[model samples]
Target: MILDKEVQRKLKIEPIEGSYNSYAVQEREKKDWRGNIYLACVAAILAISFFT
Candidate 1:
């Protein structure tokens, strides 16, 4: 099946070789402590807002 130019342009194409590097980056992002803190703060704010 042939894909339209617009559809092809919008599609995200990644190389198989880059998949490993992308996985490593994702792993590093998962280990970010600052993200955890930010999430906790947001949760606390939401909880407080709901309660009060």
Candidate 2:
């Protein structure tokens, strides 16, 4: 699974063989940033809903 691949890559217990490692790194970082943005949007929506 890609999740396992990502976790293994970050933990560095075993190095990934090749291109898969770079792809995992990109995916992880992208998701991390996206999560921050998503949370901010959700919080804003909730706050606006509350105010209305």
Candidate 3:
């Protein structure tokens, strides 16, 4: 599935609720980081497939 760049951009602009507490934010950030890494890896794999 293709991702819309604008949608991702808009999501980034919004403030997350319940993320102010240190522990909550830390856990949330870890999840977000993991998601970002996974998405990036998927994109990279797709790009590689197109070239090969």
Each prediction's whole-model lDDT (CA): 0.63, 0.63, 0.61
lDDT of 1 by residue, 1-52 (tens): 7666543223344445645645222111225598889999999999999999
For residue 49, what is the lDDT in candidate 1? 100
Pick out the ten consecutive residues of candidate 3 with the lowest summed lDDT. 22-31
Candidate 3 residue 32 C-alpha distance from true site, Å: 2.4
Any runs in candidate 3 off by more than 4 Å, and if so which? Answer: 1-31
Following a full C-alpha superposition, what root-mean-square deviation does model 3 have from the true structure? 12.3
Worst 10 residues of 2 by lDDT: 22-31
Superposed Cα deviation of residue 31, candidate 2 (Å): 8.5
Clashing pairs in 3: none
Check candidate 1 and list the clashing pairs.
none
Model 3 lDDT at residue 17:
75
lDDT of 3 by residue, 11-48 (tens): 22444677764332222222358888999999999999
Residue pairs clashing in model 2 are: none
Q: Work out the TM-score per prediction.
A: 0.40, 0.40, 0.40
Tell me which of candidates 1 and 3 scores higher on lDDT: 1
